[model samples]
Target chain A: MPRKSSRPTVATIARDLGISPATVSYALNDKPGVSAAMRARVLEHASAIGWTPHSGAQALRRGRSGNIGLVLVRDPEELSREPFYSAVTAGIEAATSAHGFELLIRFVRGGADDEVDVFRAWSHQRRVDGVVLLDLAKDDHRPPVLEALSLDFAVLGHYSGPEDFVKVTTAEPADAATVIDHLLERGYDGCLQLTGPFEYAHEGRRRELLARLCAERGIPHLHVPGTYTVDSGYRAFQAADTSLSARPAVVTSSDLIAVGALRAAAAQGVAIPRDLGLVSWDDSLIAEVTSPSITALSRRPFDMGRAAGDLLAQKIDGRIPGGSTIENSPAALIPRGSTARP
Target chain B: MPRKSSRPTVATIARDLGISPATVSYALNDKPGVSAAMRARVLEHASAIGWTPHSGAQALRRGRSGNIGLVLVRDPEELSREPFYSAVTAGIEAATSAHGFELLIRFVRGGADDEVDVFRAWSHQRRVDGVVLLDLAKDDHRPPVLEALSLDFAVLGHYSGPEDFVKVTTAEPADAATVIDHLLERGYDGCLQLTGPFEYAHEGRRRELLARLCAERGIPHLHVPGTYTVDSGYRAFQAADTSLSARPAVVTSSDLIAVGALRAAAAQGVAIPRDLGLVSWDDSLIAEVTSPSITALSRRPFDMGRAAGDLLAQKIDGRIPGGSTIENSPAALIPRGSTARP
Candidate 1:
């Protein structure tokens, strides 16, 4: 590669024009103090000199980095394996790019304290104009840290705090109601829910909603705690299958877990939607391609991401106040072969 | 949110110390010329006042942004659907975060020109120290643009150009050789290779390698152009099935396409591995969970990403010379039910 000349700075242009750097800065930035002709002359000279504004300098002056941050406090293996985070990220990228902002992502391998440290650093350094938060747990500590730091942000999950930031969520109770209604309509007598970690706020909400809905209709319901992985789903299904007298329709927190249940049923020689019924929480390609295509709640994660991105952008620009809520379309159940009971 | 006071800057510390800002900068940065006692006094006072170095100012002085960039020139829908990009990104994050560098990602919905424009803007602004380039096409224009900008970069695919840039690649020829060997061992009479778009350099290479290997072995080889999507895979399989006289074993460029082909076969009553053998080029969850789990070549994209990240980091730090090449572990064929013909 050819060794190129150093980039031209504001001082370089000022030196060429024999003018004060302050005058050039004011004229180039279109500040009010500079006369129109002076501004035009400064711009022309700066253009001729091939001077591009330094982003660092520009960010410092404007108090905006033109970047948005996303910190994922997830196991790297889990982050890579799950499709949910990726789709949401793509959606966020779609919206942020349309607004000419870049996404700065950091993966935290450690616990919540390490995640908080990242936010603190970004806040102090002004590395991003704002951020988007994901995977809200019960009493998530991140919101309070971000609030104390005065960093503009939007959450992708429900937060129960008094001080409301922008939250983009799917209708949780409606999701549960839809699932129970579908199961009852299919003539399933009992329901088994394979839930994600109860530490997550959404998981707790889903459990409570499902339990209440099942009780009102006099349907027996069982709750099994599991992580969002295929192994978790497989084990949960095996444990449920052996322990229960009657096979209940299985509802999983994610498609991965549903896939595990499908594999387990196939291995055990149990016919799906006959001896067993399976429903996945988030629909993706995985749900559609399984031997017995899984009935799934299409949460539309990409749209959720787009909504969160737009809200955060608005929050960053001070166009919208805090405590705003935008509910994405409620999760709609797409029944496939897995739940096709005759 | 609390109404917090503004953050303490260097000037604030200087004002509190009744010293010149330059002296404070020198003391805080631990530069020579400050007396030991004076430096200690300045440090104590700065710590007492909660003064932190502004990242913008520090970057301006150091000419490093403490960030790396990755640009994806892909359809947003495609990006969100494919697990490959996400896994690769997660791998990149693992490496970059380990080195204390953040990942800056920008998705370009347009063609190559728009992608190049992102590079130019990022270069001019010093928004990233170096970038990782993906999906190199025939006669790709991006390398030339990045080279001209004097930006340090690493390519994730083969770059035939003479200028030595770090490249992380898999053994394309070996991938073809192994697939053919696997097919022949399974007693498949003919081969139908469903490929991604020919515009990509790797696709062209794979096609040539497969064609040559098949010709040498006198195996009837057919190639169909598709994309890294399930729908494309479905359409390609349907077209191939109707046009061909005898059903040949199908090999797809990605798991999504394989899933599509599987769906098509199931719809048409073509028994997998018995009537038609199926293999996916990239192993993923979709491949593993399909009705007859797909036989696939595990490309280990995450490892590829990690390699690319490490190379780019080294390139940016000037630790390694240009033209460095790192070949990831060869793609291994994982035999599953899809190719278990007796």
Candidate 2:
């Protein structure tokens, strides 16, 4: 490693350009005190010598700092085992970067009490321009708190009982409705729906739709209490096998769960589609990336992220004019080797 | 919606305790300007009402602010598509948190040219106590500058040349050796190793070990480049089958790569252990959680994270006497259903 001459600092830039250190700070901040000519000179000298402001200080002064906070309300362990959030986060970054806004991502351990502390601190301290909130429950504490504070926010995959908030999500019961209806039309006598925890807004809808539609068509189902992980999916299949009168064709709330069902089926010497039909949610890179490539209802998390960022930007800029609502971005189905009639 | 009497701000704490704002600031900073009795009074009042110092204001103070920085050389797309770095980072966080240190993570686009600007600003501004540098290349530019300016750091994976640096990583070659030797002992006559990009330090070592060990054992085997994702792994296997003298009976490499290989084998109508035996590296939760539960040489990332954090903490506290190094924590062989004799 070669040692080169030390690069110049703000002080060096000020000295070379015949300006004060305070002036450099003001120019960098785009503050009112610095004259246009002086600001240009400072910027030029700083550019040549390199002047980067302490982002924290800049953030403090300009309340509209280019920082968007991301709060993921999920188990940390579960998150690592799943890829949807990461892909969505990546999408959010894609949009945020276009506007030079930094995403200040923090995970909130979502047991009611912890989420409160996490939300309050982040929102109250003005640590973010807005937050991307995920997994809203039916009676969400966060929505009320955020609404009260009037914090700019965009919810991902959760929208119930709140029309005043901005949300970027895929179709909920709509996708489930479509998949379930497809199952019924195929003359599947019985169905097993492996869903994420009931606390999850979307998964809850999936269960309700499966139950309601299945009842309307007079078909029975075993709703397995599962989370959005492969393990949960596998466990759900095992639970279904134990509880069901006979093995039923399956549907999962996530592709991860779908994969698990496939594994469980294979393990039990059950054939896919031939013996057990399966359909899942969030058809992502993982949908195509799996064996037999399970059929799934997929949404572009990248597009969802971009839309969320745009909506949050609208709120941040006060363009939404309050109490406005964006309904939902729908999900599309991608068929593969998995779904088949019993 | 109720404010709950609001969180005690700097002003609120001062007013409630009947002390000057400056005195509260002084007490918060643990500066010598405040008397012991006054400090205790401030502490008592603040704790009763939960008055934490604002992180933004605290970061503004010059020098040794107790913040650790994480520099990721990958793009946002990688952050989502690639789980390896996320696991490694989660490990780093495990270490940093145990020592009561905060991590400030940032992403740098492209190479060292503009990145040097980012690093210079971070170090000179004392934005972090130390940096954890990842993705080292041949003729790395970071180490020399870090030492010259007296910045604290922990290098992940590897360093360029012979420079002494504190690093925490799995012994990839040894792990590879163990896996290969296990496959050979399991009555497999031939094997295939799907590896990450050859330029990467971890993948390079694994590739070399697999090749050398195969030669020494006189085992007929082949190596293929894997993109460290399921899609890539599948493609690599397809390409390898065209030129191979015989189909590989055992497949191994990094977990993600192995996952791809597993899919490819399945796609080509190959049966596991019967037609091919499979194993993987890192043992990330996904591997254990995957179908057939990939047999793996477990790196045990959580413990690795804890170890990395311990070293980083010692280095931060000035306890380590020299360049940071820790003994191999030993990789555990996690045999799942993926590997067996024909």
Candidate 3:
């Protein structure tokens, strides 16, 4: 293998071909200024001499880093246990790598300030060509900051900011309506919605929609706020069980929460679908494997991530992405033993 | 906010200060050539102008990208389902971000060739200062390629190749011995080891150790090889159940596989611990929450990841990294209902 310094550079190729460095560069990069014959000659010579472009210098010249950034503001413990984000990440990786871009990920332990700081640093450094944003919060501070920095980005959820920002939305207003309709169709008298943190925009939107739908149907709706964790789900279930006079059908924002509720039900000797019904959002392998297997809304997180990646890549390449809002396949409710009883 | 071109570069700062760009760069970068007063003045002026280092230019000048890479070669379906890799990623992120480095992750869908291509590209582009490798094969081809490219990296598992490679190992020979001793004490006359694919170095080591231990103890040892998925575990269990004259204590390579086994056992109406004792490797929330809560050997994957990130960072910074082998906190066996009878 050639040593670092011994590796052929653009300058070496230019000198070997007895041409101006600019002409060689334009030819090698396939710019319009170079003639077809000159371009072919430069390409042949460069290939023969083994001249690979230095990514850093290329990034500086073109002002493109060939990277897509993803900054996740989440509890590390919560992130580790939940399969939702990982699936999304896998999808993003699939799409980005296909487009010759790498995924630059950062996990912020702190709140919005830390997340914004990351965006600022990335923007100033030109570390990434574009970013894919997740876990958007109600009154999110990131979009405005990102806009101010003139960085191109795509959000995974609804962004209530500029009309131009690309969004890949899976959760719709109809999602909560479907869950409530399922509960009502199952002959459930009341509903207990175990939501993810209220700070999240999706959770808040879900809460509002569920409340409105329940009110319309005259179903008693009780909301419990918790993090996206099994322990949080367990505690929320226990709290609802003791506070309410009757057991209500539980609808969780995430499957981990549903698993916790299942554990709680087991401990309390409350039979699933018989004594109480459960429906988990974000269906995964965990939902399918549990005893009495949970009823869940399958969102296909991988597809969502892939869409976001595609949108961001398009935005980076100066293309007006076909759609600002790419709607994912509608969330399909998979009825299992947990919601099998009518 | 300042427009992209208007943002102050070192040349702009130098021009404003009537000094050479080299002197400005030296002062800004804390290099020794510049005087203390000049360094202070440069810092003050740069701060006043809101100048942040252009990452690409800084990288070119310093020969550092300030990024660490992790390339995972796995099925996307399996990656999404299993929580182990995600947790490791979270741990790595924690350590890398704390040190002002970002994590660049790539998931390769194909085998060794695809993975090597990624390494070659990354090395050629100078994209990452170092990388963290996972799921090493017995005759892994990555290390030699990385060494040839002169890329700095750390392995999460054992490397059979060179002695100079940094290895952060959580699995040990004694891990299998412990499991066998537990099964023997539980009066299990035979053993069924449901292993991950034989390609992984860890699985091969684990299989060998289990085989040797079972031979030494005069117990019948049966090995079933499968992927690290729930379906694999379920099928392995079914095959073993139908083939074996007597039910043996089953030990799985992963929690998802164990969950599949538990499901199969439930389907077969086999009473756990009494009819068949089961222990899962790589304890996770799934293990703790499964029906008959599976007994498992808990390897803290997050800690292992953190150690790997630290090692890679040190290696990139030109430090010998104190120790070549970082033995993670020993895998602790967390006995649950599956082994409660014994």
Candidate 4:
């Protein structure tokens, strides 16, 4: 790992190659002045020396390309329905726009490795000053790669790994506990948790917390997998074995999932709050308009997004140190008709 | 407007200021070598002569920041709910990514003017090679401004009035006619069209088409406004006077609004199909998950997105001329329980 001060610069590369800094700059920037052969030689020497442009050269020192990079890695279909991202991205936008910075966003079709390549490519081209990381998975590959490249970044969401990056986490664990307590208080003997793909860091956190809490209270619970889409929620509901002695009150990861369950229940002639109770995460508009309006976790996504964006800005500006954890407004449970007592 | 060949170049600016091209490049790129006073004088001269760097200096010619710009100008809250953008953006991503281009996106809080400013800023900073314009309004302020700055761009969605730029339309007019024909065929005497704010070009087009069609057929039609959020949809549904004889069958621009109407009907004891019918646009997951799976216009937002993206890439690559229109797949009306004949 190279120390910050020791990172290769234009001057260093020029001296090593016995060339003027002007030639180095032209070759590095793909300017027309340098001959193709000389440019290749300069590039080869720079590569052998492990040279990468410092962020200061691209943004801080030169005031060039004031931008931040954010890459979204999700099925485009799923991304369209997930309100969480738009709100968070908006928050990031608000912060960046205020600072006169552009947010350079990209959507990668492939998984983590592809995402890593994107980060590398963007950084190499000096496209962004810093990046904001979202949905950090367990043993995520991003942080180490970003660290190696020495890119300023802030990780959004609860990632309890060893990466030193500015971090922000929504209160998913606490929110799950609140839902559990509410379900039990409503005299529900068993519970069903319908959640987004558990591979994501926060979903995993919620799953672990809820499962443990249910076990500790001696309450029977069933966990169902969903993709945070209406179709996935519908399928999860359709697939759940619902013939148990005590019907499980349902808790979902998103409003779309809950709505799917609600529609599935209607089709099955199961009555909400009579045969079952329901609670949804993210108090989005869908929760309000659902037939027996859903009880939901009011974890203001927009505000959380703003916090993440602001944190990234702070990290880039060097106002905050890496490994700093920002506690967002705690998630609050908003009780609605769907979770009404039997 | 300056023709392509007549556009200002580094050499042109250098000659105008009686300095070398290298000095001009250094002053413009904020590189050391040029004196601060000389740099200021060069910048002033360049600005006075409207000498913007050709895309070559930033991207096309030099391969600096292989990026494209896209600015979104919708309410953050509404953006999260509207699946249209995610699908379209994903399509754009697929194209840009395939061509090894990064997308620089930003969300602006204000309207068309704010969006115009974003385009100008991104262009002036050499942050993007070209831009992909979305949701262009009637008499949009963007194309003209973009033209004035000579920024390479492609407009997405329908903008009917007159700007000549690479264009794509979502077959919305034909889709509106299809929905109208379906409603009449299903024995619906009157129709209520629920839509996003009419100020948006597409929504306005839908509003005008439905109104004209209904008027011609002597069918009463009402256009209720919404912001594409579930709550707004709910309010629109509630505020819509349903007491008229031959109670209007609901046709919503988005599934969110249709779902909101469905829930409102359920709460009001207004049985769907028996008392009223419904149809939704976009054919999103919500349309399928609603109690009576909503009849919808399957426009394939993903494919539409891909088309927009491909078109932009072509324009940027100079494979297509400006003002070229790409016709999206014609909208297909998918019949579901919600619009069953009374």
Candidate 5:
């Protein structure tokens, strides 16, 4: 294999330009020691030769790595099945790139120790100037860890943890009302919510909000535990007693889960909207393409990601405004065939 | 906000240890001048002080940044809608993290020039020691650009373009034959393949292989354009001639496309697997959850990503074996209700 020519150093550039190394350094660093003509000559020649001052050297000089770290605490299968991570990552990338900073992403199995270890490595190595935390779990360990290390970070979801960090949260809890109202208006007297695992911070909030609203209307409601996967959704439906003549309308936490319920309904010969009503959260393309075009609340995941990215970038820039938490636009209900009038 | 104290320098450690700074430097660099006892003391003191040699300084001293760059050249919406990117990214992250390297991922809107610019930045800025490239296109500009810069890279798919980067390819073409055979076994004499945009390198290979296999069996075949999105799949099916009494079975490039076809079929009151047999590529969770559970070929995007990441890491480590191209495991067909017996 042919070896690449090593990056041209100041010495080499100075030699090529017949100038002293100190003179070249002064010109490059804008130290005002070199004449304008000589500085122009050195810079123009450096550009011609594709000589970029090494980032490592630049970072050492400025005492900043110019990087933002993000560690995902989910298994590969779970992360892949959901589009939320990818959408948020795209938004984070856009913001980081605009600032000439690179985002360093890692996927770690959901272990608090593993997460804390990652933070320690970044802190010791100075691998990032800041970090963006996602998927806030109950008893989240990251905020405290980051705080103890004196590292600046921004969490992507609301956290009631002890440490203070910029928080960017979606109006996920508020969307429950929108979903329930639509189901109620369609003449579904009672509804069942297949929620994600309770360990997740947002899932608890979503369930509580829905339960409160349902109680207010004196309607019966049940919360079935789900794992945010299609299989879980299917099992949740099967677990519901079919003997109940007044089976409640179904609402799922994710589009994949809703698709599963749709599959189970089709298998049972239950006609959608006639025999059963369904709604899926997170209006991805799958919701629109499914049979009966599953009703959904457009979470606008991309915009949420963008907002989180913007907030993290602002925190890094030390220009974040007064509040620590930001509530992005509320999700709006997009009633489709599944939630249409019977 | 309180500023973080600057990283401990050799001088600081030496002063605290009551030793000369030169002795501390020599001990840290493993030079002969430092005595064993003094070296141990300096090291322990440095560790106690939470001191780490700056990565930038170390990279400048050793001429390598412990990073790998990967840029996705796709539109944000397209990237988010497909599970392939997230799955692959997880795999890549797994491999990179295990090797103690960070993956710098960028999502670039499809522009050849922008991709080339990213490579150049990584090359000149010394941001990463090596890179992993994805989505090889016809007349790909990246291979040549990387080659000219003498950058070490690994392409995620086979590339016939001018350049000698490591190549990792999936047996996507072979999967085409599998889908075709499955269709033939189902008594379908003709099939229409809804493929992604022709410019993508894989699409042409997949289409040609399927078309050739169908021709050998004296079966009629059609290639309809698709964009790997649900909307495009729906549009492709809509654009097909329904007046033909015997419409061809449908094979789509992605699961989203197949879902779109399902939507179109439902709208026309056409029963699946009875009136129309359907198959989707890239078996994701959505495929199993959809009504009739669309039959699909498993692309194993996560494995593909891991392969690319491993190869790039190997190249960086100078341990890569002989050939530049690696053929990954061939995709396998998973039959389900969508392609059940008619």
Candidate 6:
């Protein structure tokens, strides 16, 4: 890079060299006609002022667009508030900067039919090198469509092996089991599980994972519908069997829900980790901001972003082996005040 | 438009009408003939049953790539987890579908210098008609670059001049002033402004608005320098002046910062509104979800994204008149208890 300058402008450099601004522009752009000495003076002054030519001008010759698209389900519009996704992007951007890509993030919101159409439209337009899919639904039609097209892409969530697709996801089922195993060991028996809408593929897996863990532990449990919303969690708490005989320890699918549960519990005169042992997936800043920190499946958003990027990079380079499964990031449960020894 | 389908798939239609799947496909796709009456019946039945040829097949023959690139500011090797960004995308998909544009979002994180090179690479490779930009820096170099290369693109934030860029921003400066005016009329006097990093144009304008508001009011004020990070907000509060006169009744800026301010205030035993009033931007779920609910200036992420789509659509249609800017949405103050009357 040219020698760093805090406040360098083209005019400043021109004034310093006693030349017209046009001459400075010509010299800086390297269009020539200035004496080599004048060019040297201009270069020295430009470096002193941080007046490098615009990146766009340089890009025309270097052959790159500083744009990358980050795709997600239920884009920012539909959400009342959710923190995990932003955490993931923060991580992705950290790595993107190291590699020099500008993330042009967007969302696709609607039912499954709309999702398929939206995915294909983005792919056909050649707006992004590869698209990243998250919150994959059961029997995701995306894999089939991608398979049938000349598109490059990757997934950031897991799916059953069928639609030969590239992906980066978490072993959410296993992680949920681990949290349950710990909860069971802590002597928390009856549970109310809060989760996102059932349409998501991972929701089923998370349910199954808990059921499997319950079966192995020989414990009978109750299942409740969840919308991964604070209101939902509050309602879940309201409907939960908090009776002394079958008091339920809550395990939420997300931190936001857990926070809501905590609030509801507090409203109901219940103490955290005492009346409820809450745990959520995708630990984000929310986990930290809550009154009682959340016990969650701590997945680094940056690491996850990096993982997703790696998959896309592979596809973009045509090195990705054609198959359904791409890559999986392991989800690790983190114990906080929400889940503790009573 | 095709007719709504009750039994749209080949298997379903074949089962419903006692026709073979191959015959159904041939007729649905308008392949060289069965009887014209039979073709009409097949087409009518198929339409009624929601049967249509897959997009890949159609795009393949037309030489259309069934995708739209979403360039993100992330390393090529990242897994995304940002919920707000996703919601914005959901909005984009909403528009994309209406126009038959598929969504292909990616993370391209790189240095300012090398990022555009990637965009150029994607363009040279014949991938997309245009791209969307987010997380813009002040004096963004990309719009000029996009303009110079005669490329199709739109940004989430405004550029300085229309002669060289395409942007859809919320006009944060004016919006900030409105909120500041609201606070001042309430005898809130000057606010302790907490905001995102100043490098962001939005933040820059926000700060300028706040400074100007304070200057115009002749009220002393101070801002805790920070990024759009909760941790930064927390730290800023820790170091914030606790003097009685200097303590602000209204704390302003990003919801994330307001959250931090809330936490810090709680830690310091400062009562909400009574001791300190907090105002925030982004009316995200965070605003409502925050205890006592943060007063916010709502910026419609969906409308902003759609406006950006419209700009990009215009560019793709070759109607771009020098990087046009659309202040598509204005931030409106949503008063909540966080900034309740003292």
* Number of the top TM-score candidate: 1
TM-score-sorted candidate list, best first: 1, 3, 5, 2, 4, 6
Residue-wise C-alpha lDDT for candidate 5, range A1-342, written one tens digit per residue: 324655677988999988899999999998987899999999998888888877887777776777888877768768787876777788888878887788899888866678788888887777787788776777887776776676788778656566456778777667878888887788776777887777777777777888888888777777887777777888888887543336458889888788778878877888888877898877876786577788998877777766777777787777874257778778888888897795
Native-to-model Cα distance after best TM-score fit, residue B222 in candidate 3, in Å: 1.3
Per-model TM-score on C-alpha atoms: 0.94, 0.85, 0.93, 0.77, 0.91, 0.68
Tell me what TM-score chain A of model 5 achieves. 0.89
- For candidate 2, the docking band is acceptable
Q: Candidate 3 or 6, higher TM-score?
A: 3
Quote the positional error of residue B168 for candidate 1 in Å.
0.6
> How would you encode candidate 3's per-residue C-alpha lDDT over B272-311 as one tens digit per residue?
9887889987888778767788888888888889989988
Model 4, residue B10: what's the lDDT? 77
In candidate 6, residue A255 scores what lDDT? Answer: 71
- Cα error of candidate 1 at position B94, Å: 1.2
Tens-digit lDDT track of model 6 for A241-326: 66622445677877767877888898988877776677787686567556567778876656776667666655555566755353
Model 1: per-residue Cα lDDT at residue A11: 84
> Can you list the residue pairs that collide in candidate 2?
A283-A298, B95-B309, B273-B276
Q: Which pairs, if any, clash in model 3? A: none
> Which TM-score value belongs to model 6?
0.68
Q: Is candidate 5 or candidate 6 better by lDDT?
A: 5
Candidate 1 CAPRI grade: medium
Cα displacement (Å) at residue A314, model 3 = 0.6
> What are the per-residue Cα lDDT tens digits for candidate 5 across B19-123?
788998898888997789888988888889878876787777776778888888778767887887888888888887778788898888867678888888887
- Candidate 4 shows a clash count of 2
Model 3: TM-score for chain B: 0.90
Instruction: In angstroms, give how far residue B193 of model 5 lies from its true place.
Output: 2.6
List, for all models, the DockQ compared with the true complex. Answer: 0.53, 0.28, 0.51, 0.14, 0.51, 0.09
Per-candidate interface C-alpha RMSD?
3.9, 6.9, 3.9, 15.9, 3.3, 14.3
lDDT of 1 at A147: 75
> Candidate 6's residue-wise lDDT over B113-157, tens digit each?
565875665454333456777767777787777655445677777
TM-score of predicted model 1?
0.94
